[model samples]
Target: MKSPLAGLSKFDFFGVLLLRIGVGAVLAFHGYPILTGGGSVWTDVGKGAAIASLPPSFFEYAGLASGILQFIGGILLIIGMFTRGTALLLSIVVGFAIANLIAAGSFQLGFLAHLQMILALLGLVFIGPGRLSLDRKGI
Candidate 1:
């Protein structure tokens, strides 16, 4: 006999899709002001200064790349195109940010934001794009 879970419908896919898009949208929205408006002063001037002081270029590149990657990944994720790949990429970016933040001895609010992104990434990885997603055609 089939497992009881076999009765699940494709409607569950929409749940996943909504989660991915909604979370991605929130993340993107949060970043938008920081990137385009005066908010960057707080983020860039405050954080960027210390980040720029890192020894190697990799750390600096990684720091700069995180915002760019996050913007791109958040857009892709919201659109549901290459959802898994984008989520995975976001996870990597957030993971690196978390590591750097910890290493820098600042674990208060930064850690919480990183953790939120990680949870969202994990949700996308497990639930996938769902039925409302671009990837649904393949399923």
Candidate 2:
């Protein structure tokens, strides 16, 4: 027998909206500190995204770019504007974060957070913002 909520497919858009807002808010919250903290803070945070043998100087720029993208993309996703593109870029950012977390030898809440977020972001990339979004007419 089908569950009562089996009909909830009609609410798929709401699911997308929830995903966007939730992920966007998180990105914005985390990005804000990096942006406001300037180069010094960026250098510290960029270590997460660092590739092999890259210097601290590279991290400064990487962090700066990541911060900008996270804040802007987060805002865009919240409003359902440019949802797919934002999700794609944010996926890369999350990828780096996940890699860093793994390399650091930890299995904390952050691991779960990034894991779920990446999955959602990738799904959003394919599923889009849906009918209730700015990309569609019902905004």
Clashes (backbone N, CA, C under 3 Å), per candidate, total 0, 0
Cα misplacement distance, residue 69 of candidate 2 (Å): 1.3
RMSD in Å for model 1: 4.8
Tens digits of per-residue lDDT, candidate 1, 31-72, equal 565445443333552353345556554444444555666666
- Clashes in model 1: which pairs? none
lDDT of each: 0.69, 0.88
Return the lDDT, model 1, position 55: 55
In candidate 2 the C-alpha lDDT for residue 62 amounts to: 89
Over 1-139, each residue of candidate 2 has an lDDT whose tens digit, in order, gives 9999999998888887888899899998888887888988888778778875987799998889888988888998898998899999999998998999899987899999999989989999999987777887553
Residue 96, model 2: lDDT of 90
Model 2 spans > 4 angstroms off: 137-139
RMSD of 2: 2.0
